[model samples]
Target: MTKTAIIAGTGVLPGILADRLDETNTPYVIAELEGFAMENPKGRPVERFIVERLALLFDRFDDLGVEQVIFAGAVSRPAIDPERIDPKTATLLPVLLPAFQQGDDALLRAVIALFEDAGFSVVGVDSVAPELVPGEGVLTTAQPSQDDKADADRAAKVVAGIGALDVGQGAVVAQGLCLAIETLPGTAAMLRWVAEVAKTCRANPNGAKGVFFKAPKPGQERRIDLPAIGPDTVVQADAADLAGIVIEAGGVMLLDPEATIAEANSRGLFIWARTP
Candidate 1:
């Protein structure tokens, strides 16, 4: 019975993972990062830590007999405080400081390496909760029109292009016009901005609204920071007046599949898990 540590961050996914661990009666501890609040800790024992003292946290995990670690939920880059950098973390500053400039994928990879180098096996969300990744197909009764499909194709390519540069995991395309790309502000903000733009834009005269596409970055370290959507995403897309949502099959996580699909169906928006 090896113990595992859940490095919980902000969002429902961390809470959902906590629920799964509880149901299985798994031996685990939740480590909440500083700055990002953990959602619904489920009354579980949680330890708060900061990036400046990761080495100290590792020692704590060691004392707790934790052998594996899983990163779950959303986290933005924390503003580092030079005065608080522990001696151990300071030793690695040469390697970490450059990663901070190299984009998120690089930064995450570097962080994962730190955990792995510390002898803790890093596990992916897919490995811990396979149920969150839906199978391929349109999950809604409203099928995507040919035009909608075309828009999805365009959106997919756009997401891939941006992903290659570690730019974003999502893109919104309407009639082949890229409406928005997900950035540091995240998908919710991007969708809201698209909705604002749609009010004054009449670029899509063919009547096909658009598609919201999401996927993991090309060659991304899937063990952390995989793109995800939930019922809230469906509501946001509906607000943006988009035709539907598209995700890369096996590459994206649906936070609450039943509720997400039901929302899409209720709003007449299709959730397509397409193989790419």
Candidate 2:
């Protein structure tokens, strides 16, 4: 039997992929890289391995007849210790450490290359679960006001330009004032900081505060680490006193899309999937 596995990290993407696999009755396993992956795969084989222990995991997958792999969810470059990994994996660490040190794109490309070098095909989640990609449009009834539209447009250009520098994928543009940009600290922190700043120097109190633009890095590989947001995203935006969010159409992951849209609607925040 041809075998495949979902290499789950930490987030809702893995579960979403798992559900899609189930609908097609596709048999597969879950390779849970330690320190990641939220919940255990309830109905399938779940093998655990530390992220640095690649050699052993590759051997294990080969033994289990696995031929394809899909990576989903979020993971940071953990501090790796040479003493902890098996000698076989240690030798290969030199090939990987640099990518980990680079940025998300380099690291992701390295991961895919590593798996392919191990004789396993690396595929994007879209290949296995196409339903998750959102169609292009404002996802909710709350539309961006003209000012908000201009801000969103500016944010999109700014983020895209910065993305080429491998800095980040999101930015906050409030009243033509570029408030914050995503950094190594990530989006939630970026938004939270914006909220704090807004509290100290508030907006007009009636005019739209700002909007966040998230999208794929210009000329970067897709499939891994597509921008993601959830219901709590609405809460964060509301707390930040922001106008809305704009994501690259078909480039962002909507975790629990229905609930997320509903939350955004209830909060009167615009959650749009626009062309980037």
lDDT of 1 by residue, 1-276 (tens): 668899989888888887887778888999999889877745667899998888899999999999999999888888889999999988778877889888888999999988998899999888778989877888889899998889889988998899998889999988778889998889999999988875245374657888899999899988999889999999999999988999999989999999999999999999999998
User: Per-residue lDDT of 130-248 in model 2, one digit per residue for the tens?
Assistant: 65668688889899889988888889989988899999999988877688899889989988998887534535656668898888898777868777888987888889988899988
Q: In terms of TM-score, how similar is model 1 to the real structure?
A: 0.95
User: All candidates' lDDT scores?
Assistant: 0.88, 0.83
TM-score of each: 0.95, 0.92
Which residue pairs come into collision in candidate 2?
9-37
What value does the lDDT take at residue 69 in candidate 2? 91
Scored by lDDT, model 1 comes in at: 0.88
| Candidate 1 error regions (>4 Å) | 199-206
Off by over 4 Å in 2: 41-45, 199-205
Error of 1 at 24 (Å): 1.5
